[model samples]
Target: MKILVTGCAGFIGFHLSKHLLEENNNVIGVDNINNYYDPNLKEKRLNILKKNKKFKFYKFDICNEDKIIKVFKKRIDCVIHLAAQAGVRYSLENPDAYFQSNLKGFYNILINSKRFKIKHLIFASTSSVYGNQKVMPIDEKSDITNPIQFYAATKTSNELMASSFSQLYQMKISALRFFTVYGPWGRPDMALFKFTNNILRKKQIDIYNFGKHKRDFTYIDDCVNAIKLIIHAKKKRKKFEVFNIANGKSEKLEKYIKIIERELKLKAKKKYLPLQKGDIQTTSANINKIKKFVKYKPSVNIETGIKKFIEWYKFYYYKNGK
Candidate 1:
């Protein structure tokens, strides 16, 4: 199958593209290579993918409708759209970036899909869309109308746009709401990365909400596996589906920090702080709906996941002098 994967330079997108390429599928990856964090890290990821014969890459912004349409003119089989301006804190600082990438860029992708009559479109959503819902475990049927952050709001808008496109053009679309995704090649803006980086440098790690926040940190391999299973699953016409891609297990922030400390055999100097605005107290995903359609079994527990991440981090930074 020929696949178009946007944000291929990103953490999850890079992993997903590698997985697809390993299956001998032709993959065309696109990314703006914006300096959201570090373009060097993004370039490193792209360099790894470029080594594979099955992978091709394009350096372009998703908001460029003409370029997107030109790419769609090819015989593309499926599209895994993962491009977007991520980071809740960043969204609060720069709301226009979210609008430009998450809204306008999303519309450009949808228009291209409609124009090209693509078979299936799987896009990234977020668990943040659930907001501060009183529910313990969020499901597909849960009301996602109240997003605490602009980032979450943009993600919700993507889902609505995809649904509208599905209804109008009979497109097969799936909006995957990803939980706290953390592992090797993780984003520097993410909590896990920041904490790990701080701990390794013997710096104080900021413990938000007095270390009371909980998150269902899904490992990268499990995320890629779930996506691979969904890609092959049969799709019905005009089916606009949403699924929670998570471990379905919520681990407390302090507990996670302890695990990381234990894994690295180094205690982190902690600075407990109040939770910032647009940050949720907890996030838990109900994956029953996804399990019914595809065998989405998460393999990595938090302990093992953190261990793997630390190993990768040590080798990536220490050995490579990154």
Candidate 2:
């Protein structure tokens, strides 16, 4: 299968592209390579992907409708649209960036996908869409109308746009509600990466919400594998469907920190603080829907996941002098 992956240099995108390429699929990768966090990390991810002769990457923004349409004309089989402005807190700082990429850029991809008669268009969503619901486990059917954060609102809008496209044109589309994804080659903006970096350097790590937050963390490998399974699922295609790609184990922030400490064998100097605005206190996923659809099983526990990340972080920075 020929797969088109947007945000190919991103954390999840890079891993997914690698997985798809390993499965013998010709991958067409695209990224603007913006400096949201650090382009160095994004560049490193791309460098790894470039080793594969089957991986074809174009350095361009997904917002460029002309260029995007050109790529769509390349007889693409499926589009795993992962390019968008991510980060919940960052959305608060720069709302315009979110609108341009998440809304405008997504529309570009959607229209092109529809115009090209693409087989499937699977885009990324967030568990943050389920906002501060007074519920335990969030499902596909949960109320996403009340997104606490601007970032979540953009993703919720994406789901709605995809739903309309799927219904109107009978386009095959899936929205993946990814929980707190973390692991090797993780985003430096993410909490795990920041925590690990601070702890290793003997700096005091800030704990938000007084370390009371709970998150359904998803390992990078498991997240990539689940996506691969869904893409290859032989089930009758639905016009629109949503899946929860999560470990389904909502662990507290304190416990998560403990695991990091254990893995690094270094005590973290902690600075507890109130939760920032646009932050979810807790997130848990109800994955029965995804499980029934693709037999999705998240194998890595948080402990092992953090360990793998720390190992990669050490090697990536220390050995490579990154």
- Candidate 1 residue-wise lDDT, 1-322, digit = tens: 9999999999999999999999999999999999999888899999999999989899999988888987887789999999999888899899999999999999999988988989899999999999988988889899989999999999999999899889988899999999999999999999888988898889999988888999988999999999998899964433788989999899888899999899888999999999899999999989998887887899899999999999988988657655
Each prediction's total of clashing residue pairs, residues at least 3 apart in sequence or on different chains, is 0, 0
C-alpha RMSD (angstroms) for model 1:
1.1
Per-model root-mean-square deviation over C-alphas: 1.1, 0.9
Local error of candidate 1 at 153, Å? 0.8
Q: After superposition, how far is residue 70 of candidate 2 from its true place, in Å?
A: 0.9
Can you write out model 2's per-residue Cα lDDT over 1-322, one digit (the tens) per residue? 9999999999999999998888899999999999998898999999999999999999998888999988998999999999999999999999999999999999999999999999999999999999987878988898999999889999999999999999999999999999999999899899999998899889999998999999999999989988998889999967899999999899999999999999889999999999899999999999999888889888999989998999999999756744
Which structure among the candidates has the greatest TM-score?
Answer: 2
TM-score for all predictions? 0.98, 0.98
- Candidate 1's clash total is 0
